[model samples]
Every structure is written in structure tokens, then in C-alpha cells.
Target: MARIKLSCERGRSIELDTARTALGCIDFQADFVLPEGRAGALGLPIEVLLAALPAAQRALSAAREAGMFVFFTRECYAPDLSDLNAFRRQYDVAIGSPGPLGRFLVKGERGTEVIADMRPRDGEPVIDKAGFSAFHQTTLDTVLRVRGIDTLLLMGYTTQCCVASTLRQAVDLGYACILLADACAAYDPADHEATVRVMYSEGDNFGWVSDSQRLADASQSIEH
Candidate 1:
């Protein structure tokens, strides 16, 4: 297996073995990305989140071409709110409330599904998580381990929230994480920038922060 090195912030870089790496598309659901979804209804700028779609799509395609494991995650709770935590319930009144796209963040709802453009293909795992971190009470870690995936390239909506939480957890669980900066978005550009800065700070403590283009180029180089 050829190892591809990706440059990171603060003069850092990380190497990945494509065969042991997976692409994690986190919380790219309609509720977060679409104008008619929960985020837009809550006054979050969906357009800002939508901006990352092109880069995400490009990374998804590159990962597929490189034969890297691909997986997606959605932040949704059961219809009855069985999986909803007390903190989340109190903090966000819209967790299970009705909205334009069915109950907000509820499973089996249109808003909970991944958007059309970034929908997972056949055999790709779609993990439904109730919490911010994909590994929390979900099979994400197990799925990765079962596939022998030790490195992850994470991309998706809300860099400061779900993406950051998942990246921290992935690092704690011993996975070498590379966050595709351009492939993620936050409601505020500053928030996105802050997350990226933190990710690469402290000697790349949380994870390496890189963009989709660099990843694609590195993977393509390895393929040749």
C-alpha cells in the first residue's frame, strides 16, 4: 500500500494508507443543508452550509476512485425522541418539533436524510447518530474497526459542531484524522476558521487540517 502524505497547518503533514483510510461525511442531512430544513427555519444561513457541497462532492468522488471506505452520518433522533438527551432536549426546543421537512431531526423524516447530491451509494454505511459526535451511541467506531480503517478523512456540515466533535472523538479512539477544511462549513465563517485553527494547533493535536484538493492530488499521485 502506497502512503500519501498530506500537508497540514503550521508546517505539519500526515501520511495515509488509502486502504486503511475512510471518508466520513458527517451530518450532511437536509435539516442542516437545505433552505427548507431545520437549520434555515432556525435562522441559520443554509447557503453558507451549502457552499461546501461542491468540495465535498469532489472529495467523495476522489475517495471512491481511490477505493477508500466511505461512510456518512446523520444527526437524528427517533420519532418518539427516545434517543434524545436531556441537555439537547432542553437546549433546543426544536429537536422533535414539527417543521417544513417533518419533525426536526427526527428519523424517517425527509430532513434527516442526506441531501440528494451527497447521498450515499449502495454499500456505503449511513450512520444515524443522536448526539453531536458520530461515535456517541452509534456504530461508527465499530464499523471503522471492522473494516480495518485506522485513518479518516472527515468532511461535512457545521465544522464547529458535529465535525469538530467527531474529529475529537476519532482522535481519542486512536484514528489518525484529517479534516477536509473546504469540505466542511459552519453558519459563521469565523467559526469554521476557528475550528480549523484549533485542529492544526498544538502540534496538530486534534487532527491534521487539509483541504479536499490536496487530498485528491495526494491520492491520485499514489494511484499512479
Candidate 2:
């Protein structure tokens, strides 16, 4: 696959091809983005997550309007814990055995479901993933390849974890990625800003970075 290089220089105007691009919302489930969800109950910063909602919604809507393939991802595991990684198991156990959220993203649990505001539409796929990267043990790559997607616009909860992980892997897999900075969040504000800075600093190394409004505007604009 050939690389579609774009400078991550500040104020650069990016031309996104809808037919070759897909918008991926990563780990936007209730458990991670909601104020009363597991992350909040565990004392992680819920404010940042809440602040990201509007931006995420705007970007998602724009992606849909632009006729891009929209993919939503949630990090989930089997109820039997068979799919749980050792680190996740340790983290879950540390968090009081998942408390009321069903052991760290157990499938079919209410918390595992995508938050209502950003729920998948009729034919969109809600890819269930077992780890941070959507491509890890998941069919995301196949899905994108089958759809002929070469570029990805990504946004979702947790800037430093799932979102970052997916972006890095996507670049390695030959996908041009643009991470919507304002549409994702981290527990710590410092971490959130830092991650975005790194992504934007590397040009096409990991991926490019843009704010939600800029991406939304680009997506909604006419390509011709």
C-alpha cells in the first residue's frame, strides 16, 4: 500500500477523500465516557470525558453526512473472562472486580454498550474488541480492507490509551490517520494535551491531529 503523506504542520489544510476514508470512534462506551460509569466511580476524571461528548457527536455526524464509512469500537471481553488479558485481569481485580460494571467491559453489560448519543446507526458495524487497539484480535483490519478504506479519522474516549493505540497501529498497517483531538479525552488534562501534541508533532509517523470542528468542517465540505 502506498502512503498518503500529509504534513502535520500547524494550520495545514487536509483534503480527506470520503471513499477512501472511514471514521472510527474508539471505546466510546458508557463505561468510559459517562459521568456515572466505571471510570468515574473509580475516581478517574469524568469532566474531560463529558467535555468531549459534543465534539465527538459533531465529528460523527459530519462523517455520516459526508458518506464515509463510520465504524464504532468498544473494548469488551467474554463474560467467562476467557478473552481477558493478564494485565486487564489484574487491573479489573484492582478495581474491586469491576464493581458494578461487569468486570471491565464484559459483553452485553449495560456499561459495555455504546453511549446513547453516539450509538451506531442501522447498518454501521459496532466492532467488539478485546484490547486497546481495535486491530488486536479483532476484524477491524479486514472490515476496512474489504471496504477499501485507506484513511481513517479517529475520535473517542481516552486519548492516551485506546485512541492512541489504534492510531499507532493504523499507521503501521498503512492507513493514513487523522486523530480528532477535541473529540477524545483522557483522565488527566495534561496527558490529553500531551498525547495530541506528540501525534501532531510526528507528521505522518503515527498520524496527524486536528480538532473536532476542523474535521467536521472538512468532512461536511464538498470534495470537488
Candidate 3:
């Protein structure tokens, strides 16, 4: 298998097997990242999330070019809200509420779709998840395992929430994970930085932390 060395935090690095790696884009949907979507409707800061779009796009392109399996995750619930958990229902009042872009976080709604700037390509799996962790009650794990993917390159909106949750779960599931820091964002810059620090802390106890530029550069250097 062809391999590439990815430089990680704490002066560490890891080998990425192009054939065994997959790029997992988490919750880059309109509800989370777009200015005219739920976040904006709720008066949350969408600019920070939008700022990551360029890096995310670059990483997505690089992953596709390198022949790595690419998958995207969108956080949404059933139209009837039957799939929504009690905890989420109690806290996220906007889940089924109408917003600028249809019903917020409702399946089949425009707000639940991945943003146009970094839409998934044809044949790339787009997993619809009801929870922050993409693996929770989703087919993401099975899809990855079926493809023989053992490593994940993860990036997307809300570093402190969906991205962090998915990365932690991926670690627990025994997948070698790398987080693309610059390709993710949170409403609060402090929260984003905090998540990045924790990811690389404890000698990268959870997973390796990296940036989208480095990932893109390395992927581009791979020989086809």
C-alpha cells in the first residue's frame, strides 16, 4: 500500500495509507455553516464557520485526487422528530423549527443538506446522522469498514461539537484519526482552539491533530 507521512502536533507524525484512509467531513450542512441558515437565524456567529470553507474545499479536493474514500455527514432528524433524542429535544429548540432554510436540522430539508461550496461528489457516501457523533445510529462505521478504511481524516463545522464528538467516537472505534484544524470552526474561537489543544494534548491521546494545508500538500505529493 502507498503511504504518506502526515506531520502532527507535538512534533509527531503518522503514516497514512492512501488505500486504507478515508476523509470524513462532519456536519458541513447549511444549518451549521451557512450565513443564511439556522445558525444565522438563531443569531449565532456563522462567519467563523464560513471562514473554514476554503481550507475544507482544498482538503476535499486533495482527498479526491489522492483516491482516498471520501464521505460526508449531515446532522439531521426525521421530519416527525421521532428520531430525535430527549436530550437534544430539550436543548435544541430549533431542531424542527422553521428557519430561513426550511426546517432546521430536519431530514430532507434544505438546511440539512451539505453546503454547496463543499458538496460531496457523486458516489461519495453522505451519511445522515441524528446526533453529533456521526457513528451514532448511522451507517458510517459499516460503510468505512466495508471499504477497508482504518484511518480517518476529519474536518468540518463546529470543532467543539460535531467534529470533536465524531473524532472521539472514531478513536474509540479504533480508527486512526487525524483532525484538520483549519478546516473546522466553532461559534467561539476560544472553543475551537480549546478543542484543538485537547485533541493534541496528552501525547494525542484522542487522535492526531493537523491542519488542512498540510494534509492537502501531503496528499498532492502522493504518486498516483
Could you give candidate 2's per-residue lDDT for residues 1-224 as a string of tens digits?
A: 11222333476646666777889988888878676778878788788888999999998887787788999998887888788788877765632246456655888887888989998999889999888899999989999999899889898878899998999899899998888888999888888888887875644457677766766566545543
Candidate 3, residue 201: the lDDT equals 75
User: On lDDT, who's better, 1 or 2?
Assistant: 1
Superior by TM-score: candidate 1 or candidate 2? 1
| Candidate maximizing TM-score | 3
Model 3: per-residue Cα lDDT over 105-201, one tens digit each? 8888888998889877899989988889999998889999998999999999789998999999999999998998899998999999999889867
User: Each candidate's root-mean-square deviation in Å?
Assistant: 1.4, 3.3, 1.2
Q: Candidate 2, clashing residue pairs?
A: none
Per candidate, the number of residue pairs that clash is: 0, 0, 0
- Deviation in Å, model 2, residue 4 alpha carbon: 14
Worst 10-residue lDDT window, candidate 1: 1-10
What would the per-residue lDDT of candidate 1 be over residues 1-224, giving only the tens digit for each residue? 66778876667788888889999999899988788887888888889988899999999998887889999999999888988998877888878889889988899999899999998999999998989999999888889998899999999988999999999999899998989999999999999999988975766678787888888887788645
For candidate 1, give the lDDT of residue 33. 79
Each prediction's TM-score against the native? Answer: 0.95, 0.89, 0.96
Model 1 ranges off by over 4 Å:
none
